[model samples]
Target: MKAGREELMEIIDLWGYSEDAQARIREILESEDVPPPHLFRYYGDRPGKVEQAERLFERTIGTPHALAVNSGTSALMAAIAAAGIGPGDEVLVPGYTFFASASVVVASRAIPVIVEVDETLNMDPEDMARRITPQTRAAVIVHMKGNPADMDPLMRVAADHDLTVIEDVAQACGGSYHGKRLGTIGDFGCFSFDFYKIAQSGEGGFVATADDYLYMRAQSWHDTAACWRPDRYAEERREGELFCGENYRMSEMQGAVALAQIRKLDGYIGALRANKKRIRDQIEERDGLALRRQPDPEGDASTSLVMFADSRELAEEMMAAMRERGVGVGGRFDQTVRDWHVYSYWEHILEQKTVTDEGCPFTCPYYEGQLPDYGPEMCPNTLDLLSRSMHMGISDTWSPEECDRIAEAINSAVSEVLG
Candidate 1:
């Protein structure tokens, strides 16, 4: 005999809210024998799960267009490809972001000029504008660790420089700035639904834009074989303007999970904010200790709480004391494993390590602008800010009492160490 609906609901309940994602997968498995969206039978004539996901995500993001891709890295690559940025072009990237942000520029055969970050740990508009040259084409503004970058100034600079703005919202999926969402403010918004992001589809991403022409280019880039065409078998393959590209299309399985996870994004961000506020509100602020400033506190994703010490030694001491008290804080710099978030540790770009011997992008004759002098200490401001910072992540699943305990532990650490 088959289990009843109530029994299935109960089973889903045992797994908690995230079970919706699992239930979605199970629902698809039980009802349909459908293969991936790109399968011959499942063409683009009718919307598949991936298409549905794109629509759902578009509505959630309030963007005019959104194309679901395989990964966040692919989303960045697709955005660059769509913009037609190539060798000799320079894309300004922050010094504190994931290496992929800069590496994507190199992948496009373009130069990635590293910009210094201030105390905010996001890109500095001043540094960005200072780095621009004749060949500068674009800027990848990263929303680091679920915090939106200061977009108003950055956008102004981009406008003045005629640079394409690609907002990397991988860490700030549900986050917003002022009244607008993080991804909607820029020329193109990229998001990651990886295992560690606010929303998770295991490994999935989306490229968003308000431009129709660029949307078509992004679509073509994600599925160059024409599988994403309005009619899969159309006689003119390029839709008159599209061209041959790569395959970064999201499958039905990933879409199913992505839809479910996104459905819970608001709740996730809400709980995270509430939990973070509870702990933060109780902490006392005084001399030699300051919380990271948020331009729009209400819109912040609130994934991690950062405390800046007056000195690196004090920061290290605070982290050690906090850890001993079970507050669970860690320092920002880690040279041993070489944290990918820190720009100084990136040996690939600093050393100009290309895939082949010829060093096409680095040595390409098309690059007319003078190459930048990269080094471990290129961005001293980035290293200085990171050195005196202690990071502690806030959990959406924490209880009110748990938040109180954390606050108490933090207070204790500050008194013993910073005092």
Candidate 2:
């Protein structure tokens, strides 16, 4: 009989493995040279923890299917491949996201057409609609900074253009739009559990979709060689399923910890929301500045509060003053030379660099129409908004006093800068 994961309950290591590893360091030399055969275990489930986590996402996030991968980038690449998007296909990626968002599209041999974002610092539906062309196959709508994009109009535009919608929910895992979860609303929803994300398992992510065919394709893409998963191995695949792919599967440990983190997702979001509202309420209506315009404020994960100063010089001065007052959470903005989050710093993409000298993706014959006009000035709106923005990171563990102090610092900085 195939062993079940439940069997491990019998020998449950009550003392967690992490602490035991440190405690037993020197004892390894004295341990049994020929260990007893009784220690052998077989988990009938394919990497028990990963599958368990996948199931959790289905139940918690409302996605019909999910595939665990090593990183959010891999999750996106797998999703792109699963959607049958490749050379000659152009995907719309917002200008303000981390470079990886656009790099992944390049990795998939698809052109990433940069789109402008509004003060919300997310993809603008109107701009997205304007960029579509015969070769435009999809849009990777990134819910950046833990807030959902304007999904209602975006989805309508996508539907009108017949564009595949891939929701880059890496930063907005628990965030929602209207009544649906961020990832659940798109054709494929990708999430990240990196150390920096809302709820993390160090470094992990997953791909989610409602379509069975896309789910299978994602599975096949992540596990290219068709390795033995108790589900199947070397079985006849449906047409358009088998192809050259990469290994991006999540480990048992990552899946276990990721599942635990996601289980507490709501608790984290709630604390952050409360903390954010406390600070925003005090300063949002202030003159000489405006808070970020969120389409669904209630559904926001509330990771950060962005305030746009009336001028770029004033915004910088406010940041400096806030730092003096010790409320220095402002970040991931500006045109720093090496900031990976800034698109203008992406020399590799701008220069069209690739693994081989051929620049295969860029030079591919399948590419259609005139290539997009790429330059530092391509996203004027993104640059302007970011320059005038003061980003304050919202924490889940702040005391009431901390919230008030932070709010006071912000108010002081605004007054000092704009007075």
Candidate 3:
């Protein structure tokens, strides 16, 4: 049955931080010193925060080196730079993802060759293999909406092509594949602690790498010109200054909050998974709405829950009806990277300065084209899925009863619209 307006209102009301969360924030606020450490403050006196962030990264990610950055996007850009992706180099990314996944490639003056995603809404190994060429230097596999991409096949393909695999774990903070954590699988894993993520430090990100050379390279790019002590670097450090990049360091306050949040991640992920299962049971019987299911692959870890409709219009209508009824839902990736005007028309302003793979013959020719016709049939599944997906915020804050209410609202909205 459709949820009443009151129930919908109650669901929407549950979207904000809980009283307990607010109390924790207040505690943090009261305990902090004046002027709070500058977010990118890397000066003489403020060097201690960087050490705090480094310690936090080591403890949380279980990696030797972690470079705190201002945003997940910057972390991705730095990772690409550290991997040595440059102009004329083609980096394979999913067609159905946030623009940052591809835009970072463009920002590095590299070509982002769009690849089709699987039913999991992650980069498809088959499509990734098809997209690879002599010019392909790396691939950024996004764990879209917190779902772990099929990593074994992806890793195999990357190995075959001699490409560096950079895992975009922005949405899958506490998620793991098989026995290993999501961020630790690839050459480098980038994570986001944005407000909407499972853990939030307001806004911040960190990058993890197992490679000693790449780790130090990423560290320098994150904070160039600063004298970084060798002991701080987990990986083997190069003696000379190789390349210089912009400062993308995170704040001490953000690091402090993130440390606290990291302590709660396992419990939070458990709650979210349980909530998702409850909602899934309630809505599985509906005809018009279909939830994205985790494939039973060799090493798959179920993460966030997402639902899909038949078309964008249907998805939009359902979202609108749910919102009108006071439920807060969102479209997964309705607007694809190709649909963005920035990539299509304003390419000149956003173009990067350095080009790494300048002599590669098979680099993308239509890099500046509004929409390069990779053929209508190239990514049929992703195009179809993108036109029809809707997502619910499966946060730990959502109670089991709240999940039921959301399921009821979705079922009601779909029945009313389709029947």
Candidate 4:
């Protein structure tokens, strides 16, 4: 018997494995001599599956260095450490992004200054500029939902402030910005290959950079102060001598899966982009409904289809209408729905303290006087725009019939709301 719609919806891991990916995993499992070489990434190391995956990642992202780590959050943490962001340092992050964008700053012993987002759901460069204080050291530009942020102006702002920019391309694996790949455009580009991301590795991520010093710094963080190149090794070899580091290394098994996934990434991104464009072209200009304004020099990886309505009321109406037709429409303001990606939905970030007891990051005796409190009022624009936004998932696996049904549902929902 065929499965019910509700029953099918319960199965969340839609990340189907490619035949190539399956074969690679099988080989790893079946081989007797498949022992990982230099799993710790020591110098003069023989290249294994992990190193091979790193090389492929570097070539794919057009970066000089790529260090695979345990998770996207680990990639961000390593990037933070590489940039030398520490106590009293402030990193600007969009208030509309995933929790890791802000939490990673905390983990780095730095403060995350929440900044407002524009209609594009990306960090507003103007607001980011306004939030800058003497303590501001870096900015993390998230390419939310595989849509590239406007890097031109954002880069200019960061340059003016002498702030290091890190591109959070977790959702934008195969995406680019103005012909340049998303992650390579910044000081450090971080990517996630978690099961849900564009490139699935079960659980994995990497940091990409063009600077040798930063690459070495990241390597230290990835393997507990172990040097990537032998020359950087400390003569005394004291703990935390080169720098305070942690264990965030990716395993050879994970690397094998990621290497296979990388080969199929471009085709998947291309298909999803085409499907998104087809749907957007059909419904974007309809009255009371429109696609969110994509940044100039847009790179559509088509991770999800986001639509904004004239107001919150219209957005809610359209959401209900779409759901009745079997389309799972997600709204930014729906707090009860726990999985919404909007920052307002992440109460943990606002409620929890960055550092326990001492308030080492926020209240640490580093910056000028007292730090400004982070709360809802800090990003009014983000709060407002998100109230009227809704989105639906897009995937390479979607069939033409599925696309048609979605388009029809969107059209009908708009008509129902307008009528």
Each candidate structure's count of clashing pairs: 0, 0, 3, 0
Model 1, 163-281: lDDT tens digits are 99999999889889998898999889999988888887889999999999888888878887876466876776444346778989887767878989888988999999899889889
lDDT of 1 at 393: 92
The Cα RMSD in angstroms, rounded to one decimal, for candidate 4 relative to the true structure is 7.0
Candidate 4, 1-419: lDDT as tens digits:
43333222232224465667655655565554333334344452476677888998888878899999989999999999988898878889998878888888887778778888887788898998989998899999999987888888899999999999999999889899888898998899999989889997899999999988888778877887565545666463443337668988887667878999988888888899878877776774666777877774247678888888888888998999999998888887764666435666555556545447766676667766346575656677887788889988886777777888788889988898897
Question: Cα miss at 340, model 3 (Å)?
Answer: 5.4
lDDT of each: 0.86, 0.82, 0.71, 0.80
> Would you estimate the TM-scores of all the predictions?
0.89, 0.89, 0.74, 0.86
- Please give the lDDT score at residue 190 for candidate 2: 91
Model 3, 1-419: lDDT tens digits are 43333343343355686767766655675575454334443543655654676676667667777777878998899899888777567788887666788778777877677788877888889989987877788999988777788889999999998899999988888777876778888999998878877677789888888888888788778876544655444443466335677878776657767777877877777777777777777875467777775643222223455778777898888888877766678765444434441122223323432345552222446343232344445567787776687766665677777888887887788777777
Of 1 and 2, the candidate ranking higher by TM-score: 1
Candidate 2 per-residue lDDT over residues 1-419, each given as its tens digit: 53333333222343245545634642563453432222111243244777888888888888889888889999899989999999888999999888889999998888889899987799988898999999899999999898789999899999998999999998898889887988988899998889898878789898999999999899889987767345555555578777878988777667778889979998899899899888888874567788899889889989999888878887878889999999865655666547777777777787788877878688889997577888878888888888788887888999878999999988887788777
**List of clashing residue pairs for candidate 1:** none
Candidate 4: clashing pairs of residues: none
Model 4 worst lDDT run, 10 consecutive residues: 4-13
